[model samples]
Target chain A: MNNMKTIFLCLAILIFLVGGVSNAGTYLDSAHGNSTYGVDRTSTTQYATGHCAHCHEQHASIGGDEPSPDSPAGPDDYLLFSDNHTSQTVNFCFGCHRGTVGGYQTGGLVNRSYSYRAGGWTSDTLDNILQAFTYGPPASTTSSSHKLDDIKTFITGKWGYTANSNPCIACHNPHAVQGDPANSASSAKSSGTRGYPVSLPSDHADKYVWDVYGDDAGEKMSNYVYQAPYRSGSTSIYEPDGSTTTTDGTNLTDYVTLCTDCHHYSPTPVSTRLGNTNLRDIDWAASVHGGKASWSKTDADERKLPYKAEEKNYVLACTDCHEPHGSPNYCYLIRKEVNGATTAVAADTNTDWDTLCTRCHTYTHESNSCINCHYHGALHESNPNQPLF
Target chain B: MKKSLIYIVSIIFFIVLCSQVNAEVAGNCANCHTMHNSQSGSDMATYGGTSGNNPCLTRGDCIGCHAYDTSGTDNVVNIDGSLVPQVWHNGTKDLAAGNFKYIASNDNDRKGHNVAAIDPEDTAAMFGTNGAPGAENALGITAANFSCAGKYGCHGDRAVTDEIISVKGAHHADDGTIDGMSTGTSYRFLKGVLGLENTNTPWQNISPTDHNEYKGINGPDTTSSTTTPANATISGLCGECHGYYHGTNTTETGGTTSPWIRHPTDFSLPSIGEYASYTTYSIVAPVARTDVSAVSDTVNPGGTTDDIVMCLSCHGAHATNFYKLMRWEYDSTTLATALEGCNVCHTSKN
Candidate 1:
């Protein structure tokens, strides 16, 4: 009886271990794992894309030689070539995702900005991620971007960020990150690939879901209330590809909900680029751009054609006037192009709002006057300060 | 003849029952075990070790199979059809027992258990004597006897001296439920210890709903010299080696009651006051359950039999990135933001 029981238990244990087989379907369909253009798995003609060897070196060295750009100390954990991150610019993911300088880039890649990709706005497509982050310095001096160092520090302190972790993983799940979808003219103009690129930063370890921002019942724009903005001249056609129908579900992503995962009411991060000043908290649900808020005592006649079409009551997505990555126009990541217009919004001093704000509203007031009452914490501020400290 | 015939029928019934059970370690046998340790004119041993040196016919040693030096962000990796959990992972998500990544990276003794095979002994003043701080007088855990597994260590048979030999047959043994009857059936292979193993997330990802259920006894009576008590609790497993920490000796654990010297273990959480707010189980400061049959997402604290304070509530079993292997930033957290690890139970102290 004892021996029979023992045999049964062994069989059970074996079944349990085998049950942990996970699929790489999400990664296989991503841009980095696309076999036709992805990184060389073993060599030019070897395993190719979708192979685990592209990022992971299980034996520490490949073909009896260590992989390039490895840490001098030793091989990194999880058999990666280098550490996850060492500095703001020195991230492991940027090794292949970067373009032109500092980091190497794999060929046949199409990396575009959020405005051009998702919003269907005419804007400069970024060559690499480094180009996006390096917008403020030398290239477009006064432009602002998300401080990677600040993200690294904040996430490390709050989350379970280890020595080998990359801060980018907080918002981006590399394995399951999708690209902008096709059909740029549809209101359902989804972001590339099938899955959503961004994730809830706090829930960093959750399994990557393919359609996190899908057009499903509880997904994408359906999770929140939103109204699609109008195109430049066409009042019938809406933004996100000049669609005739407004995308309340199935196509548009809820940028307000996504960005506010970190930029919301509390735990405001201190930006290293901004001399350690606390980032301003945003209450987008109560803002004028948010459809629920009152627009009384405001000039609707001063608005642009797109704004005039809806009388400035259409709820705005964060990408409606801002770029997620980096932008040529400073104003703290204000989009270079807005409402399908070709004319680029010029970069100005931190206080100036007309360069970007005037794209939708014809504000001829003082440079910083528009932001005084039209900001995130507008009503509560005793003294409204400039953006980016 | 009738008894022998019945035994054959019992064996057949058991085989069918075993076929339906889920196992912990599976996949190709050659992935872990090697008959000769040689493959296709080249050595097949992992962790840079020679072919035939590893014990139990394994391709790599304990640390070699469990951990590796890497900068990648993976807590678990696929090893030939098997998902192997890493103890020294570089990822943000460490397993429930904890990670040994800090021991090699930081070289700080306080960050991890100073396994002799992984790193050297603790050179700090408190452990400079080469003896564990809270070890019992009879079984003094010195540097000479310390290792990952042996008679002196946590895992495997305590009666055996050889590390690999102590845990022989454990990996292949049938570990259905943690009954603590055998080494493999024990909680995480800890001999004679009982607790519900976290199968969800494979012990890598932890949350309020998904985590290990630890065993504990409410209100431990320890006024005399009782070192190795067969309590079957998770705290009792720690007390088997570090006995003084769980005792009530005035010079050691101070007193068992409120105005105590050292922190108390095997005590029930008070339901009233700020502690009551901790009705939800925290992955940071986890309380042990009185009943280890199942894992509870909620905590019934303050005079309840559930939610017993254990040593793991304050410290990790293997390693962490904080000083003293704390589950949180104990050294850096201030009084203003006292809602971290320690303040979870001792609410008013903040």
Candidate 2:
């Protein structure tokens, strides 16, 4: 019994370090799994004992249940402690981190809850229409989770039904994962054969090239992208700003093409990282890093940016100006400056619709409302040169 | 016979004397300066004494016809003594008084005239406030204020050339012009009261080589064809001034690119369109957004290529309606229509 106690304790510590069994299980090779949990020579089963269940358990749902099925008593398939799909702590990952679990909640309050129906997500694009961190009444399974599941079921079931399909996890993690996933595309490899649709972490080697945009759905699971002047440049490569490129991995275009699962604008070979289906999302349209227009881009004429055409080169990606998933500002995105202040430009305030307006700050006009400028009155009615309504 | 001859000689002398005085008033400044050294001063009403610096003008020289039109001419400040009533009209002569001739000051170089009007204004501030000077606000010309709400173009009119004009006066005078002054093609101080000598033209044809593609300083490298005019690359010339419209949310207004890249009228922007069919129970979808894919409703982001608004169609440098300084009548909204702006001139409506 003493030895058994030691074994369980060691397994618990191992699970915590590898961020639970879900990821540790992904590295079940001769090199990683053995080192993490000590190989059970008697059993080398897939999804054995130490997997997703070792670290996470969904419970105390959005509203239905309090500490619903709290651990030790969970489900069979994915280790759902309860209906976390509908938690007041909307973000399943925020439950333990945002001061919920005792003794383990010490790294300051991590506000992880997000509104799936706000701004770009909802019908209201107005700035004051809603708040960003309003702990919405525990997501009634009907409003949030069901809508997503229903969409996901259709996406996984059909190939090309809707021009603009709503694939649930297309932009989401569902697991509320923090930090990097081990089998992350960086260290992943393709495990399954080509043509069929099964991808293991190792199968995703980084040869992410493309004829027309890209074709990676798992790219969202990775943290790298190509940083160049033109998105369509021949020299484009997968890059995640602040990281270096490696010739050691396979740049799999097939896996990255998965991004198109939701970017259903057209019928292209490769899927895009942005929403526009037929056309690109205009990422390079105004993507400047740190809000300064003079940045290096492979397609840019130069970086000395004058006040007009190609005046300042832009760097891009949602993460360039925002947090991992979403933020407090407009559409939960990021920007360089806000409402005139420069220092601490990106994070000074929540990314709001108004914050988005200030991104093009020097633009002068009659109202602070974005509708007055970009949309400006009604179509064909408002004068183009003059923005005054 | 001797007595009749003496009467005829006296009559001839009177005719010659009268012609001499009329000739003096008809010519340009040289007419007055030709004899400024000896004047029997006449004005006791509105004229101030001429200083050595003002050799071209004399006391009350502009008092009669111009006296009422240029209410502050030679001595007063504004036209009606009230700045609000300052007149900016042109083409017609400044003849509110009984005498009505071109009442321009003898010396346009304000120093040659009176103090009521300011000496000069800065013209760079008028062209969209992003640093592109336009008609009437042409640089190197004399203006009254740097912040003149210098107007140009009109809204809701078909495109026209040389339609731009300018308005002018002195200090205590209006600042910017409601009409255009010049567009790299025109200049101030033409021979006539109005510039260009009345041969109409606002913006002049410029060589891209002489000016920068985006800065209007040096020409950019582009292929030219017989069908297209010389130096007619849209990127080089058009972007030098309207670069603000092209900047993304990340870029500030006035930012430039080698080739201009304007916004394609979408949701990320305000509802500002030529005529919006999107308000108050109008089931029109919103403008398209780059980030948004799905929405509460499906017909979102409005239309893309078929129904989009571009910068060139709705705007012409020389055509407009309001104050003759805009491109369209945005204030008017004809309901339940695709409206106009982008779809107007680009009639690919299939």
Candidate 3:
């Protein structure tokens, strides 16, 4: 019996050691799973690193006490401490991920707005995730946000999502989502790693690779047959900040494929900014902005930098003119800055579309408002033969 | 005196209880077996009723028992305190071997191995039968004639043609520890294959330390055996049906070095260059271990034999949502369009 006991103990020790070295699930590598600075900061047991208690309350309690005030009464859905979502301002994630930390939680939570990281706009004021989502007035026509309530409602009805679940989860898996580690290190606008933060929501569970976009082939903009745009005003500088050498978009994310997963011709979501379902469809393939057609500005002088020759055929990244979360700009969630220009250069009134258009194209056309002739179906639907200037 | 006797009795009871709990299959005989086909004036078979009386006088056949209907939220179900892993479940989570539901779906022949009865044979013009795509032309095994056990299947004795007889007493006689000694003691009952079975969680919710410990070798010389070799490895077991896929055989795999004809398996990942970046083990693209007696989750690449690539590095054993049961979306043209699979290990190729 003594010999058997010793053998059993040895086997148990072996199993434990082997399992410990393996490091286990993908969540352990995520930002939330970081040992020094992650969800464990909120753990009642300080050294319980990467424990599920940060998000899930197994028995609707924590450390032999009731959960924090942010949480709902009793065991919440999925054993989450708080209700998945409550409202635009009272969402569960806002407890820690917002600009202002709640009294119950620890402070010093830092996050950079997407515009600053991707567009190199140093003047971006949206410091946290919540501010970016609620940039402008609720349902305002001029400047619009992603509309969290609308997203929550749509996902619940269509994808059978649980009621009040965080709509942000529609695009981001918190457990497996990667964070901008560079942001934690410094305040530099262009310091971000440009990791693929947003998982394809339709295939959210399938996400495996991240942070290797610059090195990988298909994930980078260079693989899209792209011709890099120039920085605003400077003829030699590139669009992704002031790179002297011309590029084939080696430093841009393939936002076209990621955004088009939902914003395609048929199954496009209802547009909150336009206040209509009919305004949703954006078939990039058939449009002048998308692939399949070349820019038909006859004179090279008429076009701006990067479009040196006539009939330039190049695919454009969606981030070239738009902000992902929201912006303080006047129309279409347009960027506060574009083509590495000074901040707020693209902000304009509804009629003043040239402010955004001239960031890439030369302001030579008669109409200051490009939308009058360059609507979604203008060139592709009305006059297929006519070339875009 | 009385208190000491009580303490000693309690200790012995705890030991006996632990031993009983470790038994692979411990439950009432009637839960699985049937003396006669009649029970409470009805057939004892769990599926298809009286008409589907299975061989070996068991309650159900392989699919009938293993693929028992779940709550659409569970991968495992308890029958008389005996835990059973489901291969066809609607739950969000699936076991390590994967689920068979993908292949059973309409027009999804490439999604998985299309077993007979459970799944229809491939009807594509290229494949009149459900023959494996990369399999050698001589060894004929197709979906039309494939089954859950015996000659054409993975589990139990491959030489035996009878499904029930091939895996005769495996379940009842299982001792839990898998030493590759017999059908009952083999890893997941894969006959002669050697591995450490994750008995507690089975194959569901696997972690690096808690996953099956697969057998592998560094710089393998498989020139001697044309068929699945005497030394059993997980890759070697797969080589039984798909010998062409096994990388060690010089004739089958062209050559062991780079600039190869066929993609190599059972080959050590070079520690230097891009391969070294994969210092951590990824469940998405798992490797095998040189020593099955111990396990390590970290990858040493060129430094150790534990970084040897196997057939499973690219494919799932049962099924997946991707084409040809690939672990990742191989058909995606752009990385932005879908998740990376081949590039997970190839590192620089993406």
Candidate 4:
């Protein structure tokens, strides 16, 4: 009796160490059997017996002990109950995650669809994930959809991603979500792959994880922290007067490091593959928009910027004037359009140039009459002797 | 025998007439000289002179002799009561050539040249002030002073110091003709001064023809093209006092090109443009004569014979009411009429 008690205690300890057994409430578990196809169809598994049975079976069952007792099922490829129509890796996830599945109907999980609005899918049922992942116009066209198989091939071929890896699993870990929801107040949902140690073919080992600490317990987790690979090196923070202070390790919250990881050195190939990819980090360090003192508070006062600050130490971040996931205007410009008539033409009076400039410099007159002070432009344009403007 | 006697008498009369015509100081010897150096028991030489025991035998020093009396008239009187041209007159009269009287009464250094004894060296002008470009200090004329006659002075030998010594022979042997006279050849006894002569006696109330003609040049398109007509010009005389301001070369003033450089002195005005309209000389912006032969008997040369730019075109030879010795109030001139100081030549710029 003592030995039996000891064996039971040891088994319990082993189970706890290796993670507990999958149960009904879990993502892989089901409450009802697969044969019953009604509103209470709560199973993600096809056989409704165990977790492995959700995707595969030991042998094809015929008449007895089968959930679908009336149906003949002597053969199925890969031990799957149904045929794989789409060659995409994400299609497997889409089958149950789609609203037509048993999990959503039973109010077990939210229904998510990749079908775009133009394909007769209502905007109400669509998620932003689908919008960002979908490559097509507001429609569910097959050709326009980004195939996971193709992406997997391309990433492996171009970026040297491991051949065996699936594009969906590369960024998302399905089993264990790493972040603690209690510690964060961010609106952005944490990815399950957050703490996964990912080894790149390149020299660096990127652990896709947050530097969790007690000090940051109640702070909102930034989206940039999740996306950027953890890099260990000195990163310089610039001051308003072009001076810099170097700190050990990259600031995970900074967009400069986060966006430049894949974009900086590998721009030429990426730009060739995806047109209109703005590798902005290349220009950001020296640009006036980035942090350089191109505009001043005096200039701002002249233009009448409403929220004028006492100190001229303000610097702009990438998100200040741009939307990351596209906006209605071209280049995802946040406030005003920049394309306008050239400086010489008198007809440029109606251009939005002033409106764009006045985003910071608000007091400058929004007209095409710059001739009094900027006389060189007009003089150069008029004088044939002076070819330069 | 009667014809010979008549010829001899005529020859003697001609010699006496020539002697009087050449005389600059024609008066009784006693009026200017005192051999004993004593008069009425007082030492005349030591009593009234800049230096003690005045050996030149003059009444006073250069300043004293030329300065006006308390009643504002000439201090020195000739035997015939004809007064010499006083260089330093009181402000009650505006003399022909200009006077140093304004310097003392106004106490304005810019009112006159700040000659020694008449006034102190021009403190404001030594390093230049009031927008006027400075004189070339490299030439060792950091301060302006005057001598009676020498290179540094204005009369007979500009380099000499003692006025009576340098111009001693000139006073007694001066002939008032452009060609025949050696001493007074430099128009108004300025020694080597070259200019066209006019008929204003004692130098006052000058008209275009009555004014002293300044030497200048016609054109080879630009003033800087040739160096032939430089040193003898009236502008060159002013350049001796203010050296860096002479050239038509733009680089000298840290500028770019011709005409745009320092104003083109001694350069001919273009006859085809707005300059042609200035046929009647404006007294405010007078040009000089490039051809000295063009001046004859007339007291007013009517047309464009005076179209060449000279130093005096923008400035007065003597004192004026304007700053920088400018002939007119350049700042007060307006752009509306285009008939102002600079606009008189730069017609289209406004």
DockQ of each model vs. true complex: 0.02, 0.00, 0.01, 0.00
Q: Answer with 1 or 3, whichever has the higher TM-score.
A: 3
Q: Candidate 3: where are CA atoms >4 Å away?
A: A1-25, A40-50, A103-105, A139-142, A156-165, A185-194, A205-216, A228-246, A298-301, A342-351, A364-368, A380-382, A385-389, B1-350
User: What is the lDDT of every predicted structure here?
Assistant: 0.62, 0.25, 0.61, 0.39
Q: What is the lDDT of residue A60 in candidate 4?
A: 26
- Residues B1-350, candidate 4: write the lDDT tens digits: 99999999999999987676643566655555567666787655432243445546765555555553524664233434435556665545455445665565435666555566655554543534211232332222323445434444445544455565555566556445443133355544555446665445335535544555666554323222011223455665555554344543333321322213235565667654335455555556667675664443221222434577766777766555554455655323221221245445644322
Query: Per-residue lDDT for A80-112 in model 3, tens only?
Result: 666667766667666667654542234446676
Assess the local accuracy of residue B322 in candidate 1 as a C-alpha lDDT between 0 and 100.
74
lDDT of 1 by residue, B224-341 (tens): 1222234667787777665555755544454455433345678888766446767888888998887877767888877556688888887888888876677876544232122257
Candidate maximizing TM-score: 3
TM-score, second chain, candidate 2: 0.25
Give the clashing pairs for model 3: A19-B209, A22-B297, A217-B350, B271-B302
Give DockQ: model 2: 0.00
Q: RMSD in angstroms, candidate 2?
A: 31.9
Q: Give the CA lDDT, 0 to 100, for residue B217 in model 1.
A: 79
1 or 2, greater by TM-score: 1
lDDT of 3 by residue, B225-271 (tens): 22333357777777666554554544445456542334567778877
TM-score of each: 0.47, 0.25, 0.47, 0.41
- Model 4 chain A worst lDDT window (10 residues): A225-234
DockQ of 3: 0.01
Identify the leading candidate in terms of DockQ: 1
Model 2 quality (TM-score): 0.25
Which residue ranges in model 2 land beyond 4 Å of their true spot? A1-52, A55-79, A87-168, A171-178, A181-315, A321-324, A330-361, A366-368, A371-389, B1-350
